[model samples]
Target: MRRVSAISWSLSVFLLSFFFHLLPLSIWSEPAEPTPAEWPPKFNALLFENSSGKLHVIDFWYDWSRGGSLRITQNQLAKLTYERSWDNGTSYLYPSEIHSPCWLMHIPPGILRPNWMEGAIYHGQQYVDGFLCNVWEKVGVVWYYEDAVTKTPVHWSWIPFPGEQSVHVITFNVGAVLEDVDKWEVPDYCFNNNNKLENDEEMKASAF
Candidate 1:
């Protein structure tokens, strides 16, 4: 009777070990990070920017096919300005308003694509601006957050010298292209200026 009982106990233990080994590995492993969704070829968004306490509202238009981006900004003083970047390694800033004589400088395009975030370190989920977001950090230079459900960008922040600046997407409209083509035309004065303007630190932070 004792010998029979010992054999039964050993069999039970072996069966338990086999069952555990057959369980899926995922049960004990961390979930894989999700890939970020690609931005639409043509889209626009209303952005609220907070740069070390200074605030601005921006109407941002992005057109990958045209290889250009336009940012129309209204600063705290209710003054309007424009900044346009082209793939041709040039950017123009109309400091005062549209049609204003703009300052031209060399600035490469910094638009984000899906693959750009491929190697970014995922930080899991967090709440940002009242929305639950999946966050990723890239090269310790910037933190990007996307809405967990919609996959739309919620916010992004970068550290520039002296401070960190953040931009939040107030509204995003995909497949929305600027109807006014003339809005993208570079003012003649922009090309006429012989001197190139130095890149602003704020502008550098806003890239990407």
Candidate 2:
């Protein structure tokens, strides 16, 4: 069973967000302390992660307006699904995942921290999903694309090897427009525990 516990997924989200934002800190030789008022812009994204041969797909959504967030994770092999959100009093559709949204931080500038670009191979410009982007690559991480105009990371992956190599890719700016507010709601089906599915073969087989 390649099931990832909720704790692990929550930790991955935190760690990935940290790595993405840390580029800015590394770019500046000497950076001034960041303040809450200067937080980065709010946007939604779709994160695709491939660990070894297993796959995990996440529909990641965020909005700074009300500090709202929605994350839907699907485990391809196990057929497990879970959702975590922070809209009305922070909640989770399944106990597997927790509501931890404070860990993700957005930094200003939104460009590749040049200092970390050492030995990074620039593949020039290319189109990804209809958007033109500048590509770059380095071991353990690959910059699939960066928005040509905004210079923001559109597609990238982190290949961290714990036991076997795990590839984590994040696709930013998914929906052309911000998602509907109600989309963040806990579906009525999830209101009752009867619909909850555990990460077991039997449950997984019938959940869908």
Instruction: Say which candidate scores most in lDDT.
Output: 1
Q: Tens digits of per-residue lDDT for model 1 on 1-208? A: 9999999999999999999999999998987778677778889999999988888999999888888789988887755778888767777777654344566677554544436667788889999999999999988988999999999999999887778889999999998978888889877776776345665654444331
lDDT of 1 at 87: 67
Candidate 1 vs. truth: CA RMSD? 4.4
Please provide TM-scores, in order, for all candidate models, with all chains considered together.
0.78, 0.38
Model 2, span 1-208: residue lDDT tens: 2366777888999999998887866575664322111213455566776656667787766555545556666778554444544434444444233331112112233323323445567677878767787776676454545667776655655555443433333655633344465656654445443333334353334442
Best-fitting candidate, measured by TM-score?
1
- Alpha carbon deviation, residue 159, candidate 1 (Å): 0.6
Q: Any runs in candidate 2 off by more than 4 Å, and if so which?
A: 1-40, 77-82, 87-149, 154-171, 174-180, 188-208
lDDT of 1 at 3: 100
Please give the TM-score that candidate 2 achieves against the real structure. 0.38
- True lDDT of residue 145, candidate 1: 96
lDDT of 2: 0.52
- Distance from true location, Cα of 74 in model 1, Å: 0.8
Q: Model 1: number of clashes?
A: 0
